[model samples]
Target: MAEHPAYPVGLRLAGRRVVVLGGGQVAQRRLPALIAAGADIHLVSPQATPSVEAMADAGEIAWTRRPYEDGDLADAWYALIATSDQGANTAASAEAERHRVWCVRSDDADAATAWTPATGHSEGVTVAVLTTDARGRDPRHTAAIRDAVVEGLRDGTLVAPHHRTRTPGVALVGGGPGDPDLITVRGRRLLAEADVVIADRLGPRDLLAELPPHVEVIDAAKIPYGRYMAQEAINNALIEHAKQGKSVVRLKGGDPFVFGRGMEEAQALAEEGIACTVVPGISSSISVPGAAGIPVTHRGVAHEFTVVSGHVAPDDERSLVDWPSLARLTGTLVILMGVDKIGRIAETLVAHGKPADTPVALVQEGTTAAQRRVDATLATVAETVREQDVKPPAVIVVGEVVNVGVQSSPKTSE
Candidate 1:
């Protein structure tokens, strides 16, 4: 039989009782939204999945631990009938109907008084898609539409800039180990909304191409071993653009705070009374070795991992790292910006208590194309680097953990 089209509406279930007649996959999937809405949820089920039981244990919901009863829907503002027992679901639906509470049935949508739409959230906006037919509902189609809308909104393609409240500020966004897909969702969304981007030489460079034509992408002149004046210039540029009421993003490689001088930029902005939002990216210290199939820490291998910058030579007074203490430890050591100083670092460790034959791996351009791994020992790493002609922006992993999970062949990347 033909039926009227389903009407769409948002439910404000805060501080209201919502009864759920199942604790299986359906309830497990839908309960989070209800809980997030501040609903007083009561779940009735004789058995529940471990995740649902965890919710009950966490006191997020009240679990009856029994099958549906006649008065279970009493005083319920909303009801979800998803019990495996069809008779129990039917009885619960009938009770919800008698009480005039809207109910959704999992097994029998035809008897449902309400339909749940496929929903997605982006930038404080909720996108919900629903399609009803006399034959059947196409959940996959609705989900695809919902995904498309959310993606468009998140990437700024569907955004109406005129309707948005533009607040000019600086966002120190971590671009994450040179991979375009590795950046955080918030960071990507902010980049999409940016009016001007002051980007570093490293990081996800491909994303800059996707920015709208109106966005001014500035290649920040941050030369390796450059004087402090270069950083000062970048800071001045950020402040200047933000003062002009333009939303600016300082996109950097890996995490902003992890040897990226992000705190300096944030401090600079703070002194100017400008708002700065820091979005963390995946640090290459851990991610690089992992990408090359080397776990920084492994069971029964290395118990701890230490990350330190190799920007300054061990003999250099500017170096803050305690090389002697690191050499004494048996844990894994992940070095960033240390490709040039690997020979000095290796000699220092070997001169200390560290073994000369300790396994080491250099992961260059990790988590992206042109990535490669070079394996060597502590005594031979300096020579191996020279032989291999490895460059900067490489992560040097030291310790036996480099040998664990060794799936990638030497000098090759997938």
Candidate 2:
């Protein structure tokens, strides 16, 4: 294979309109970078995988629930053609070119205006790995090399220029899911070094008990569907505490970027020239379900899985969701923040042709001691959740594999 040429300068896609022409895992991986760059993303696909839909629901991206049309590129500043279909990718590339928009074809590297680099970030810095023509390497191999480089840097064996900063402050870490044991070692070390602790309500309380008694503690819990400090206020507090040279820990449950709004706070700190670092956490979306004996993917049972946020803004009119396609697909659907809208969501799925008796499970406080499971059919899950008073911080798993959980339980329990 011939090496693809590299661009002379990397463009910052901040606030630009970029259209992604797929909705699978590849697109999911790409979506975060575009979002982090503050790109206005319009995803053009007939159906969205769960992560894409969740991003759409969170007002992070726009969705076009139809096949890519030439017109879709009309307003796009750049396009990422990443569908599995090579022909579709070619068509998308042609259309993008016709509309004078820069396009990156995932299936054809040479056709793209720019290739995405495997990127890593530390406080106040981002490192992107791009292959030089001399390397003459496979993109996959390049990505693997990038991962190794990132891992080495993270492990402190490789000293990148940015890591030399001696700035004394705290990094708010996302502890991930409910498993105290799952907290990253780096996060654990940071927790031990903290001068003050401010944590979310959902994380394991026992984890905080380990902190030294003299360390100041503040409760900055934000309950779903309940009154709490606005995100702006939380950011302000973190910055204020850090400015005083206090090592403050703003601990959040789950991967901070997944739904914790860590990015927003990071960006705010960047504007103020405060050095900030993020230690990645395992996301609960996959881990929580696995803990409950539910596999998000299985051979033939599900080739794909979609994760969505059940929480929606009251005034948003865009239905970024394609319930009908989701209903028809043979895959698993996982929903977070779905307790309140369980009734509406169940109704939509059933109304769109999913069986009324489709298996559904509401796993509450997953991976924690308080974990609870409520099982019901699609038609009755809403009522079941209401009757049981199941609340947020719960995950809803829908599809055939749900039946596995139902069957595994003792019949007498049901």
Local distance difference test scores for all models: 0.90, 0.77
* Candidate 1 off by > 4 Å: 222-225, 407-414
lDDT, candidate 1, 349-399, per-residue tens: 999989999989898888888888888999999999999999877999999
- How displaced is residue 21 in candidate 1, in Å? 1.0
User: Tens digit of lDDT per residue, candidate 2, span 38-109?
Assistant: 998999888888988999999999988887766778888888998887888888888887888888777877
Query: Deviation in angstroms for 22 in model 2?
Result: 48
Per-residue lDDT, model 2, residue 92, is: 82
The predictions' CA RMSDs to the true structure, in order, are: 1.9, 14.6
The local lDDT score (0 to 100) that residue 94 gets in candidate 1 is: 88
